[model samples]
Target: EITVKWAGSHPDNPLVKVILRPGMQMQYLTTHEPDDAQMECAIAAMQTVLAREEAEAARATDATEAIAAS
Candidate 1:
């Protein structure tokens, strides 16, 4: 497992944490502040990472199937 933590000096700075599996790609963003902007940014970042992970998983699955069929 992979874990990441971000700390900010001020409440506005925002903090983020990301965790992922051994071979999986995952991104998590966390903020100390309750501002909408900070939360929005975090969400966007997480979404981007998730999309990338999904694409990678699909590619791996396709490769595995091809190998098994051959």
Candidate 2:
């Protein structure tokens, strides 16, 4: 899988690309090594996405359960 987006609102060149392989290998290609701040922002962004996805999945599960009970 591949995804490209900004780490946050602003940076020298915030746009980054992430690539993942079936074996769980990951790659982050950039002109320079990411600083602590940039890594933190990226982690936060990933967590936010995961939280929203989990909430949506829970809602779907609840809906399915309700339908089964009817």
Candidate 3:
């Protein structure tokens, strides 16, 4: 199980942490910061991870099928 933590902070401000698990995706947006650009960035990051996982799953499935065929 791998954990990736993304932390964002403004100058002289406290850090905000977002934890992403190996097989989970997350999107975060805050009403306090209505124009929060971080939301899109976080979503993009999760999409990239999800895409990689999907590709890996497809490869594994193909390998399994090939093994069963043989």
Candidate 4:
């Protein structure tokens, strides 16, 4: 699973950790490495991801229903 989590503090950046696994095999990266200029970057990313997932799930359900009808 993919997730964005709190890493720590930074003087200039939001310092977020993007974790791409559960535990030991997890890989971490940060958007703070390049320092996002927008203060709402994290919030915006979250909203976009959630919206996209919801849309995809709806599309999948619709496709399943259409196939069942045919």
Provide the TM-score for each candidate, comma-separated: 0.53, 0.55, 0.50, 0.44
The residue pairs in collision within model 2 are: none
At residue 42, give the lDDT of candidate 1: 94
- The number of clashing residue pairs in each candidate reads 1, 0, 0, 0
Which of the numbered candidates is closest to the native, going by highest lDDT? 2
The predictions' CA RMSDs to the true structure, in order, are: 15.0, 14.9, 13.7, 13.3
Tens digits of per-residue lDDT, candidate 3, 1-70, equal: 1222223233223332223322233333323463568888888899999999999999999999999999
**CA shift at 67, candidate 1, in angstroms?**
0.4
Q: What ranking of all candidate models by TM-score puts the best one first?
A: 2, 1, 3, 4
Global fold similarity of model 1 (TM-score): 0.53
What are the per-residue Cα lDDT tens digits for candidate 1 across 4-64?
A: 3233323244232222232233222432456899889999999999999999999999999
Where model 4 places Cα greater than 4 Å from the true spot, the runs are: 1-39
Among these predicted structures, which one has the highest TM-score? 2
lDDT of 1 at 45: 96
Tens-place lDDT digits, model 4, residues 1-70: 1222223232234333223234324433332354565647877888999999999999999999999999
